[model samples]
Target: MLLTEEAMKTAIILKMLSALEYDVFDPSEVIPEFTADVGIKKGEKVDYAIRVGGRISILIECKAPNAPLDLKHASQLYRYFSVTDAKFAVLTNGYDWEFYTDLDEPNRMDRRPFLTFNLTDIDTTSASELSRFRKSVYDVGAILSTARRLKYISALKTRLKEEFDNPSDEFVAFFGRQIYDGMFTANVRQEFAPLVKRSVSEVIRDRVNARLKSALLQNTTEAPEEDIDLEEKSEIETTEDEWDGFRIAVAIAARVIDPSRVVIRDQRSYCGVLVDNNNRRPLLRMYFNSPTTRYLGLFDGEVEEKVAVKAPVDLYRYADRICATAEKYKSAT
Candidate 1:
C-alpha cells in the first residue's frame, strides 16, 4: 500500500512512467521535485515533470493513497501549470489519477479534469486514453485535439449515470413532453418521472441481456445432449424474466468467478445457474414459473433455500450470498 506521498511517487507513479517508456533514471526525461517559480515563490516544487526534447511537457503531482484528488488538492499543480512549459498536468493518489489540460483557456489549468480513472478499475476506454500518454507515441497536438471531446463525453456519461439513478425534473419533463399530447403539468411530470426511470432501467437491462445472450451463444455452439433430450421429453420454455434473473445472477457471481463460467440450464421445474456447466456445482436457481410470485434458490447451505423475489432487480439484494456461493465453488477448484 502506498501510504505516503513519497511512497506513491516511487512505487506507483514512477512505475507507470516506466511502463510508458519514460526513463525514470534520466533527469531530462523524468525530473523529480521539479522547481517552478510561482510569482513571488522562487522555488515552488512540483512532484515530477516529464520533458520531451529538453522541454517540460507533462507535470505530475502525487498524494497519499487515501488523499482525494480534488481541485483543492491540485493547488500546487494549478500554480505550476502557468509558470512551467507543460501542456498537461496529472494529480494522483496512487489509485485515482486525474489528467488536466488547458481546454477552457490557454496556459491555465481547467477546473475539471479532462481525463480521470482509477488504476485498479480501468475500463477499455480509459486504457485507450491512457495509451496516448506513452512516450513512444506522445503527440501534444493529437492529445489536445481529442482531450476536449473526451472531456465532454466523460461529463455526458456522468450526467447520464446520475439521471439513471435519480431522474431530474427537467430530464423527466423532456421525455414526458414528447410522449404525452396533453400539457405536461406538475401532476403529469410526477406521474411520468417514475415511469421514465423504470423505462430507462428496462432498456439498459435489455441491452445487458442481449450482450449476455450473445456471449452465451458464442460459448455454447450446440445444446448438451442431456439438455436436448430433456427439452424433447418435456416442453421446457425459458421466459424473459428467467433470462433476466440468470443475467442478474451471473452479474452477482462475476465478483468471484467469470461470467462465462456461470452457465444457465433450463429445466421444467426451474432455470439453474451452474459453475462450469456442472449440476453438482450449482450457483443459484430461478423459480419463475408462477406468474404471481418468484423465488431465487440459493445454495449457501446444505439444502437449497428458496428466497422470494419480487423482480429480477431484487436478486441484487442477495449479492453477498450469491458471491459466497460462487467463492465456495471457485475455491473448491
Candidate 2:
C-alpha cells in the first residue's frame, strides 16, 4: 500500500502517467519537483508538471495515502497555477483523484474540481473522460468546452445521492403536495419523509432489476428439447404485475445469492422464482391473479407460506424472510 507522498508518486502517479502515454523518464514530458517563482514566494515547488509542446499543461499536487486531498493540501498548486502556463491542476492522494480547471475564472483554478474519480473504482465513462488528458490525444479546447457540464453533472449526482438517503423538507414537501390533498403541516412533512425515501429506494431497485432482466433476455438462447416440451405443456401468461413482483423478489434475494441465479418460471396458476432455474429449488412464488389483492408465496424449507400483499412495494416488508429463504437454498448447494 502507498504510505508516503514519495511512495504515492513513484508507485501510482508515475504508472498512471505512463498509461496515458507520458514517458516518465523524459524530463521534458514529466517534470518532477518543478519549482517556479510565485508572487512574493521565491521558488515555490509543485509536485510534478506535465509538459506538452515545450510548455507546462498540467500541474499535479500529491498527498500521502492517509492525507485528505482538500484545498488546504493544494495550497502550492493554487499559488503556482496563476504564475504557470498550466491550464489544469490535479489533487490526488494515491486513490482519489480530483481534476480542477479554471472554468470560473481565467488563470485561476476553481475551488471545486471539474472532474473527480477514484483509481480503485474507475468505470468506463470515467476512463473515457480521463483519456482526454492523455499525452497522445490531449485537447485543451475540447476539455474546457465540456468541463463546466461535467462539473455540474457531478455535483447534481452527488446531491441526488444525498437526497435519496436523507431527503430534505423541501424534497419531501414537493412530492407530498402532489399526492396529498390536506394541509402541508410539519406533522405531514415528518410523516411523508420516510415514505418518500422508501419509494425512491424501491424505484431505483426496480429500474436496476429491469435492466438486468433486459440484459438477461438478450443473452438467453433457445431452450433444450426437454425444456421446450415442458414449456409447451404449460400454457403460461406472465403479467406485468407478476414480473414486477419477481423483480422485487430478485432484488431482495440479491442480498443472499447472485441475481443471475434467480430465474422466473411462469406456470398456469402462479409465477415461481427458482435458484439456477431448477424447479426443485424454489425461492418464492407470486400470485397476482386476484384483482382485489395480491399474495407472495414464501418458502420455509419444503413448506410454502402465502402472505397477502397490497403492492410490489409491500414485498419489501418481507425482505428478511425472502433473504432467509435464499440463504437456505444457497447453503443447501
**TM-score (C-alpha) between model 2 and the true structure:** 0.66
lDDT of each: 0.80, 0.79
lDDT of 2 by residue, 181-276 (tens): 989999999999999999999999999999989855853652421344555645567887777667656655655666667778776667788877
Task: Give the clash count for each candidate.
Answer: 0, 0
Per-residue lDDT for 1-333 in model 1, tens only?
445778667766776776566889999789998886455266668889999977899999887786877778568788888987899999888778889999999999998888887665455466567767877678999999999998988899999999999999999999999989999999999999999999999999999999989866864754452545644646888887777677656655655666667777888778888887777888988988998888999999888999998766566567668878988888664
Model 1 poorest ten-residue lDDT run: 222-231
Q: lDDT for model 1, please.
A: 0.80
Assess the local accuracy of residue 103 in candidate 1 as a C-alpha lDDT between 0 and 100: 96
